[model samples]
Target: MADTFAAIATPLGEGGVGIVRVSGPGSLNIMKVVFKECPDKVEPRHVYYGHALDASGNVIDEMICIYMRAPHTFTGEDVVEFQAHGSNVSLRLIVMSAISAGARIADPGEFTKLAFLNGKLDLSQAEAVIDLIKARSEKPLSIASDQLNGSLGQEIVAIRNNIKDVLAQMAVNIDFPDEDIEQVSCDEFITELKRQNDRLQSLIKSSEFGKIAREGIKIALVGRTNVGKSSLLNGLLGENRAIVTDIPGTTRDTIEESSSIGGYPIVVVDTAGIRDTDDVIEQIGIERSKNEIEEADLVVMVADGSTELAAEDFEIAEHVANKKVMLVINKEDLGMTAAQSDIDKLKSIIGCDTGDIVYTSVKTVKGIGKVRDAIERNLARGFIKSDGGNIVTNERHKDALVRAKAALVHGIELLEMREPLEVAEIEVHDSFQILGEIIGETASEEILDTVFSKFCLGK
Candidate 1:
């Protein structure tokens, strides 16, 4: 028998309502003992208004409660939920009342862990539940929801089914070599293996986009002080997130905010200007700026179009030469006073031959739209378009595919060499079992513990 567990499902704070959840074989019994107003034969799936009592019969709260019976609840066990006032004290007391009635405080993710153990959700789907809760944008939420609904799992299962069919053919050849059956030709084996290999490789390649969708792209804005970096950030963010002033190194540290480019999540980081400075703090900030550029997925090299490119400008350009870079010549409103030769020189140094170079006047928000377009074109060239595709967002799933792909490739090589069917079947079966780990069909205890450990209490 599974031990009963109870927890506060909702966030702890003052709100209109909070939920206390209980799950296990003893869930209904605990409810019957604590909910004094419900009849002795309380019906499942029915709502009841009552005052909950502790084991000693002390009233804990007056609230609405619902009971869901075994095999249909979230944990596939008996469950009880209480909708009470969102009082820290009251909700804790309610949980305590349930504990007093024989339930224990649920560990982090224990509820969802039970769901996984009870066959309610596979390992990937159970993992998606946490991803769904943590998603901050539309695309990530959609991807997580799809995974929860078994999109990725279904794909893996389908691939496994194809491999099983191939294994069956190989099995017939092994079981009865002289039984007058059509043998699996090497050509047929090679063709089917190649097809399944293509599908597996495509799914693995989607992990890059999946990671971007989950963590968002990081874009760093780098330039000298007073070159309108702050102004540009303010304009793009549509607010004054960073201070704009004539003082050099005003932004002593990195200022970051989340935004979207072409509906894909992005983190725009405005770093301190990259320049030679004697002030210790400004030097520190400049060093941090260099680190940000190194880590950024995209670096925007802002330059003053009103002045000639200086040694510092060229030096900054060199720093971002290797990264996916854009050159934004700010202060175009100053009449493009800087010679075109110098502007072209800056781009040449930064290697922005085919990259975006949009002039902007941040004071008037001129060319801001072009900047956004340039960002989309530069950073999100191959970004997923949220077209309801099965984007593999988990590293574990990707690893399984990678190993499975290797196995399939090996199996194909063996078949191509005209090896015995029994020899190739071993690799094919390995591939099948590896994929089974993704959907929890053959997952071990350690993997399950590691996954559920990331979840919050009560799911």
Candidate 2:
């Protein structure tokens, strides 16, 4: 018998209502003790209005409670939920009352863990529940929801079934050596292994875009002082998020803000201008700016279009030479003094011939849309389309796929070398188990603990 567990499902704060959840065989009995006006036989899946009483039979709060019977509940157990006024004291007392009525407080993620153990959800879908909760944007939320609907699991199961068919062919060859059957030749074996490997490679490729969608892209604005970096940041965000002024080092520290562009989340960072500065604080800010450039997914090099290119501008370009860079020539409204020739000169100086160069005026907001489009185009290039396809967004899934691919490659090599069938079978079986780990069929206890530990209590 499973132990009964209770927890406050909602966030702990003032709200219109709060929910206290209990799940296990003893849930109904606990409800009978704490709730008044309870019928001797309560109907499942129905809400009953009642007063929650303490251990001493004193009314604690008027509440609405619902009871869900076994096999249909989230944890596949008898479940009860108390909806009471959103008061910390009241919710705590209710939880205490349930505990006194023979329920124990649930551990973090215990509810979802129970659902996984009882076969209500696979490990992938259970993991998706947490992703859905922590998603910061629509794309991530949509991806997580799709995974929860079993897209990724279905794909993995299909791949496993195909591998199983190949294994069965090998088994038949081993068991019926003298029988006249269509034997799996070395070429056919390699072909089948390569086919499944290609599918794994496709899924691995999708992970890159899935990661970007789950975690927004980070873009750093790098340039010399007083080049409208702050202005550009404000313009991109469509609001004044950074201080803009004529002072060279007004922004001595990096300012980060998030916004959505073309349905993709992006973290825009405005860094201090890269130039010679004697001030200690400005030096630290410049160092931090260099670090941000190193870590940024994309670097937008802002240049002043109103003035001729200076030595400092060339120096800044050289710093971000090897990074994924987009050159932005700001202040175009003031009559562009820096022309295409200047851009070519800077590109040559930076040793980067390929980059998106957009002319914009933060003051007039001209050509800002073009700059944004360049960013979206660069980020979305070669990214897999998210249209109800199985996309692996989790690092664990990627690692497992990598191992599985390696095993398949090894198996194919063995077949090509004319090694004994048993040796090749070993590698193929290893690949099968590796793939199973992704959907939790072969996952160990430690992996499950590590995964569910990231979830919050009562998930």
Clashing pairs for predicted structure model 1, backbone only: none
* Candidate 2 local lDDT, 1-459, one digit each (tens): 789989999999999999999999999999999898788999998889989998888999999999999999999999999999988889989999999999999988999989988988888888899888978777888889988988898889999999989999998887887899878877988898899999999999888887888778989999999999998899889999999899889999999999877777789999999889889999999999999999998988999989997889988988898887888888888888976787888877656436477777766555668778878777766343645567788999999999999998999899999998889988999999999888889999998998889988767
| TM-score (all chains, Cα) for each model | 0.92, 0.92
Please list the residue runs of candidate 1 whose C-alpha ends up more than 4 Å from where it truly belongs after superposition. Answer: 235-239, 333-335, 353-355, 363-370, 385-388
Worst 10 residues of 2 by lDDT: 380-389
Q: How much lDDT does candidate 2 score?
A: 0.87
What is the alpha-carbon lDDT for the whole of candidate 1?
0.87
The true-versus-predicted C-alpha distance at residue 60 of model 1, in Å, is 3.0
Candidate models: Cα lDDT each: 0.87, 0.87
RMSD of each: 2.4, 2.4
Candidate 1 lDDT, 1-459, residue by residue in tens = 789999999998999999999998898888888787878787889999988786678887788889999998889999999888889898988888899889999999999888888989888999999889988777788889999998988988898999999999988988988998989777897899899999898888899898888889898999988898888788778898999888877999989998877766889999999888789998998999989999998899898888876788888988899988899988888877778888888888877755588887767755777788888887556466444558988998899999999999999999889898788889989999999999999888998888888988878
